[model samples]
Target: VEVSGLPPNLNRSCCDCGVYALKYIESHMLNLPLDLINEDNIREARLKLAVDLWAASKDPVLIDRMEKYEPHNNSSDIVDVS
Candidate 1:
């Protein structure tokens, strides 16, 4: 499938970037002819890939900003219906 025109702010926030990462893997990487991920190696591979990406970006400020976000507190004023 041809995926295009992702949201402009897809990488603006940590959550959005995470979603984008998952989408990217699903759309592109998963189709590659490799069986590197399975029940036994998935966890290790996931952590390794995340660390590698973080190192490649070399943007600790963005990581700190993402860590500081508190969506739950931001929406605390709203009443929950369920």
Candidate 2:
């Protein structure tokens, strides 16, 4: 697996496609039972994705933002601040 290639010290690698796959998975996870996506679930999924992105970037700002993620009640797309 591609994840097995990176050294322990360099755990972050920009696998662009992998990132997209994560996005897709997040979307799927957020989809609702009535075929109407739940905004809260989507917001949670987005936060998780942002955390993953922050880990891959090794950027302090992103990392800090990851911890401060707030789930908004309005819309799922709005929570995707990453």
Q: What is the C-alpha RMSD of each candidate to the true structure, in Å?
A: 11.9, 18.4
Query: Can you tell me which runs of candidate 1 are displaced by over 4 Å?
Result: 1-36, 59-82
TM-score of 1: 0.29
The CA lDDT of each predicted structure is 0.55, 0.51
lDDT of 1 at 38: 35
Error of 1 at 17 (Å): 16
In model 2, which runs have C-alpha deviations exceeding 4 angstroms?
A: 1-37, 59-82
Q: How close is candidate 2 to the true structure, as a TM-score?
A: 0.28
Error of 1 at 79 (Å): 41
Per-residue error (Å), model 2, residue 59 = 9.8
